[model samples]
Target: MSATSVPRARRRSAAPPSVDGWELFAPGIRGEGTAARRAWRSRYVRQSAILDAAAAAIAGFAGYYLWFVVFAAYGPRPPLWAVLVFPVVWVPVMLVARAYEERFLWIGVEEYRRVLNAAVLVLALVATVSWGLRLDVARGLVVVTLPLATLLTVSGRLAHRHWLRRARQRGEHLQTTILVGSRETVAALDEQLQRTPEQGYKVIGCCLPSRERSTGADAFNGLPVLGGVTDVVDVVHRFEVDTVAVLPGPEIHGSVLRRLGWQLEDTDAELLLAPAVTDVVGPRVHIRPVAGLPLLHMERPELTGVRRWTKELVDRSAAAMGLLLLSPVLLAIAVAVCLDSRGPVFFRQERVGRCGETFTMLKFRSMVQGAPKLVEDLTRADEGNGVLFKMRHDPRVTRVGRTLRRYSLDELPQLINVLRGDMSLVGPRPPLAKEVEKYGLDMHRRFLVKPGLTGLWQVSGRSDLSWDDSVRIDVRYVENWSLTFDVMILWKTVGAVLRGSGAY
Candidate 1:
């Protein structure tokens, strides 16, 4: 439908029900309209409240059991009043901390952060009460219970989010979204939403900035043009949208946006300002108010610091321990490799490392002897991207090599590379000389950190990723490298390796 066809909202004299201080009712929408919208407004809110209450009860019980039955730390037994008051205190505190708020519940780390904050607040409250009343308390038990309660609470929340994510994949419980920006921005936003429906946004249509005047295009990038920027309230009423995403563009200025916020102040539709800077995660961006204006401060990544040394230490230590612990498996694999083929057990290749340096990357041989010599003959049969040679049914792969490659046992020897500082446990993939030579200026950012045996590339799709996608993810990793991010990648790598979707 064109923007001009959207029905205008009927202005009402009486007030509508407020949502988080904004009016949520579409005045003209009748029948079961306002009541139905009001009911859904608190759907996730109530869900979160019930889940948090259950988490609090479970954590409280576990904490009490651990303190009294297991540890017996509070002089013969803990106080009954203290045990009973925990869940009572915890749940109310969580509610007060805004942990059950709809905005942060299942979307991002903010939910986890709120849970942690509530845990800390509970601990502080208990400590203050104990000291003030001069009550005999077990410090060790308190320590144990605090962390235990926190862990349980966060885990419960994660489980809920997992369930929600699965439901969202089935196209349920999604926010009907409308984009308010230029055609290009709206189209771009739509593509991202489609790629990750688990984000809970379903873009039904879009409103162009030129809605005040006529835009030549009726539909854009497969989405219906609902109306112009000025027609947002009318469009919201027309479609009964749940979210209004305002992308960065010339048509939506500061004054224009303030007016929109005021207009939306009486509607349940959420106003989201999506900045133009894309692919930037939360850790890299900070907002601060200076002289009554919110200023965005972009933090450049910190690649060198004590944290970097800590990561290196962890890499080397883990590599050494892994080699020792898995020696039996390693020996069995080596024997298997040797028995499967006549050539040496190990294969080494020259790969481009950080800053264009060359290093010998080790792996169990996953191909027949003289495989390099056969590459020229099989060039016509290559099913891989032009830069990297790969084929699902490569003739050069031996029977055992295929099995080893399928499960990534062939890459186990790269632990040595990690120990030697030629690679990291998590980073961008090490590129071959031929591939590195094809890199553009932006692609060169991948070299800022050492390559890895398993990284964004390995976990994301391995050999299935296109050259552009490979470069995009690799550069993103290099620009946003952190210890926590590396650890997350390492954890996710286990599942990716198990699935082995893109492995040849």
Candidate 2:
């Protein structure tokens, strides 16, 4: 064997699993000691620190510059020192808000929550201070800064996440993990970790229960068997593992978990339990310890209420303003479609809407005249999921139609639909009358809300989604509808459309 490969190979075979119960197949201990791990982890942390401070400082300075200098709003200016001092004030506010908490960094929406929370508190504090201390600051500056600061921070976070994901994809700054659960569960969990390598998990080995260890296997689903479940502590120390992922199974009971957590208190390894229930995001799932049992409380589905009304108000207002602002672009598209294809400038199709109602959805014509008649001929060669027809290079799409569809310009007419209350700015994609006919009972849940101009389907692969995935995404959207969720989807939609991903 080659010299480098020999050392790694020898380490993997160095010792048998402990007689007590866990396996220890970690090669990382010898190659990557605690010092090495510290060096590797600090790279991302340093990058995050720099970006966080820059975003806050930029937002603070820009807000002051725009209101006091550019527009020169008609109001008494605060002391000149305040402009210079603004960013410095926000840095502490963010620190107090726990904006850079290590647990929240590079994962979850909690980071975004903290950043925005800091912005809100800062604004409220400034208003109170200005009024109470006779500082007479213009109200307009406060108003502009709230959104500007929050937006800039969110932007910086997204860029950092993208950069970190690329780094993780290359196998950098990954947390070493050891799986502790049933062979079956560990195998399944291994698949999950592999599927999302961007999460930066490096599953080095596994610890199976005693009953399942007699299989005479060196590995479980390609992950080395470190030792028996009882040897979790030894294996963790030996590997210097950063995380011990305990998958769902009867073997890892509450007492065992508590003890494991206690033992790991002195070690760097963190014990993470993978709950049996999956696909439920943090917003819907809550934990409350009632009588010592960590009972998971599931929030009821938000089908309609004040939140829905607020969404409706925002949708209509934005749509009306969008139509007025984009009138020139819309007119240009209509003229271009007219010149490219022998079809009406616009195409209207009957689609299933909220509560099983039907409405005419509008779009610029991106197909030849009477394209519906060609569906029968193209049925055998349809590229889309069986229910929704999509063609990446359909002969019926004109040159201009192709260009329009690429960037979603064909969807501009849907702003009118949004204004008319027949659709939302974000929701499930409207199904055709024929497509709805194929609906099973579960599929009907998508009609619980207004059809969307662009939705989970649009931003998450659009025409590329499988039939099952399309239904799943739409149902998930219905069950977890929220204004915040809608805003996030809309923001992602811009990047999705810009890349022309999954658009026909």
> Best candidate, TM-score-wise?
1
Question: What are the Cα lDDT values of the candidates?
Answer: 0.78, 0.80
> How many residue pairs clash in model 1?
4
Residue pairs whose backbone atoms clash in candidate 1: 23-266, 23-267, 24-268, 211-228
In terms of lDDT, the poorest run of 10 residues in model 1 is 2-11
Which segments of model 1 are wrong by more than 4 Å?
1-43, 72-74, 79-82, 209-215, 376-386
Candidate 1, 1-504: lDDT as tens digits:
221222222222234232222223222223334346446538766676676666666666676777778876556566555565666777889887888877787888899999889988988887899899987777766777678777877887888888888887976666777889987788667766765778878666678877433746545665666678889999778667778999988878999999999999788788999988776776898998989999877799888889889989999999999889988998999999899888999999999998889999999998999898899999888776556788999988999899888889999999999999999888888888977777778888888888988899988788886565576688889878889888889888898889988999
lDDT of candidate 2 over 385-404, digit per residue (tens): 66677888899888998998
| TM-score for candidate 2 | 0.77
Model 2 worst lDDT run, 10 consecutive residues: 2-11
